[model samples]
Target: MTTNQLVEQIKQKKSFLCIGLDVDLNKIPQYLLKEADPIFAFNKAIIDATHHLCVAYKPNTAFYEAYGIKGWQALEKTINYINEKYPEIFTIADAKRGDIGNTSTMYAKAFFEDLAFDSVTVAPYMGKDSVEPFLAFSDKHTIMLALTSNAGAFDFQTKEIDGKEVYKHVLETSKSWKNAQNLMYVVGATKAEYLADIRNIIPDSFLLVPGVGAQGGNLQDVCKYGMNDNVGLLINSSRGIIYASNQDDFAQMAARKAEALQKEMALILG
Candidate 1:
């Protein structure tokens, strides 16, 4: 989807919530096992329950990769379902993939061309060449890793390099790429303080923040520091919403969780 489209959805729904589908077989309700495809079954239920409350859906690729071929098929089915059913909701393949140019192109094709995801999360450790290939796709977005929400992020992202943080450099450098306009970023919600600095570098770019409910990152803090004129933020809540309950009412429980977030977002937007 286009940036204007994304912003429009945020306004129309009074939300910029991106519900993450980080499903795990061990963690899902045992009842779903009776289905022909439990993973897809769980995802369908979650999507049905929370679609109106969210502007985006991100399925972390690791969850599907773990189950091998069946996992991949399930992922394809999930993406197809979302595209056919709710094309307005942005779809992100949270793959965090980056490689040399050639391989990166293939990766881009896999997510953008084949699976038809609206965006893909990419790692910038390999520098611009690795990430630019994904950016080459005009109709899609490249969500580069910025300041992440993990404990290990402090190990390098915040480390000062030439008196500037490594992540700060990544944001600055990424903006100069040929297809920079299509770039979004992954700035963890826990590092809300950095949002001001992040905006200083790229105020207009969308940020896909992934740490809120289960990770304990404050939603208000993120909006306070990160929101722009367009309210450029896609705060994601994975485990807290999708895995809210393992009972038969799991979908409804997930909807309740998403609704609470959307309500807060509505107040923020107002």
Candidate 2:
């Protein structure tokens, strides 16, 4: 989806909540395991129950990849279902993919062309060439990792480079690359305090923020520092929403959790 389209969806729904479908098979309700594809079954129910409450759905690819081929097939089916039924809901493949130029291009093609995700998260540690391939796809987005929520982010992302934090340099340098306009960023909600500085560097770029809810990242604090004129934030909640219950009524409980977040977002957006 285009930036304008995404902005419109945020406006229309009065929300920027991105439900993280980090579907772990072992964590889903026992009953779903009886289905031909439990992961997809769980995802379908969650999507159907909470689609109206959020503007985006992000599937962290690692969850499926860990399960091997069957998991990948389920991942494909889940995304196809979302595209077919809720095309307006922006989809993100949280694959965190970034590699050598040639490999990056193949990875971009896999997610952008084959799987047809609206966006995919990428790592910029490989520099401009590694990340540029993902950005080259005009119709899709490349969400580069920056100031992540993980505790280990300090090991490198905050390291000083030419008198500036490495993450700041990444943001500055990336803006000058080809097809840079298609770049979004992963700014963890836990790093909300740095968002004002990050925003000054790229005022219009959307940020896919994970670390809310289960991770204890404050929504109000994130909005305070990260929001822009277009409200460029996709705050994600994975465990808190997806694992709300391991019972048969999991989907309903998930919807309630999503509704609470969406209502909170509506007030913040207003």
Candidate 3:
């Protein structure tokens, strides 16, 4: 989807919430196992139940990769279902992929052409050549890792180099890559304090923030420092929402969780 289209959805729904579909078979309701495809079954229910409450759906590819072929098939079915059923909803393949240029192009094609996700997360450690290939696709976004929410982020992302932080350099350097306008970033919600400096470098770019609820990142603080004129943020809550309950009412429980976040976003937007 286009940036305007994504922003329009956020406005129409009064939300910028990005629900993560990181399904774990161990955590899902056992009753779903009777289905022909439990993974897709679980995802379909969550999507149906919570579609209206959020602007985006992100399926972390690792969950599917773990299940091997079955996992990949389920991911295909999930993305196809979303594209056919809810074309306006921005879909993210949270693959965190990055490699050499040729390999990166293939990765881009896999997610952008074959699976048809609106965006995909990528690592920037390999520099521009590795990430630019993904940015080459039209109407698609490449969300590169910046300041992540995980504890290990400080190990490299915040380290200094030539008087500037590594992530700051990543943010500034990425701005000059090919099709830079299509670039977004992954800034962890846990690092809300760093947003002011991040904004100084790329104020208009969208940020896919993961680490609210379950990770204990404060929503109010994220918006307070991270929000822009367009309210550029996709706050992700995965296990906290999807795993709200493992009973027959799991989907409804997920909806409730998502709705609460959406309501918070609505108030923030207002």
Candidate 4:
């Protein structure tokens, strides 16, 4: 989807919520295991229930990679379902991938062409040669990791390079890459206040923020510092919403959790 289309979805839905479909068999409803593809079954139910409450759905690739071939198949089905059923809603492959230039191009093709995800998360530590391949695709976004929610982010992201933090350098430098307009970023919600500085660097770029709810990041604080005229944030809530219940009402409960966030976003937008 185009950035304008994604912005339109946010306006129409009154939300910038991005639901993470990081399905775990251990936490999903027991009854779903009876289905041939339990992961897809769980995802379908959740998507069907909560589609209207959010504008995007992000599936962390690790969850599908863990289950091998069947898991991979489920991942394919899930993305196809979203594209066919809800073309208006954005889809992100939360696959933090980046490698050598050639390798990165293949990875980009895997997610952008074969799977047809609107966006894919990538690691920029590999520099321009590695990340530029993904940014080459038209209309497909490459969401680079910036200041992450994890405690380990301080190890390098905050470490000063010359006079600025590495992440600040990242945001400033990435803009010079080819097709940089297709670039988005991953800024963890845990560092809400940091967004003030981040916004100053790239006020117009969209940020895919993960760490609300289960991770204890405040929704309002993120918006207070991160939001731009387009409401440039996709606040993700994974465990808290997807695992709201391991019972049969899981999908409905997920929708309720998403709706609560959407309502909170509507108020923030107003």
lDDT of 3: 0.95
Tens-digit lDDT string for candidate 1 (100-178): 9999999999999899999999999999899999988999999999999999999999999999999999999998998
Model 3, C-alpha of 260: deviation from truth (Å): 0.6
Where does candidate 1 stray beyond 4 Å? none
Q: Estimate each model's TM-score.
A: 0.99, 0.99, 0.99, 0.99
What's the residue-level lDDT of 223 in candidate 4? 96
The C-alpha lDDT values of all candidates are 0.95, 0.93, 0.95, 0.95
Q: Is candidate 2 or candidate 4 better by lDDT?
A: 4
Model 3 misplacement above 4 A: none
> In candidate 2, which residue pairs clash?
none
After TM-score superposition, what is the CA distance of residue 172 in candidate 1 from its true location, in Å? 0.3
Indicate the worst ten consecutive residues by lDDT in candidate 1: 189-198
* Model 4 CA RMSD to the hidden true structure, in angstroms: 0.6
Q: Can you list the residue pairs that collide in candidate 4?
A: none
Tens-digit lDDT string for candidate 2 (147-252): 9998999999999998999999999999999999999999989888999999999999999999998887999999999999999999999999989999989999
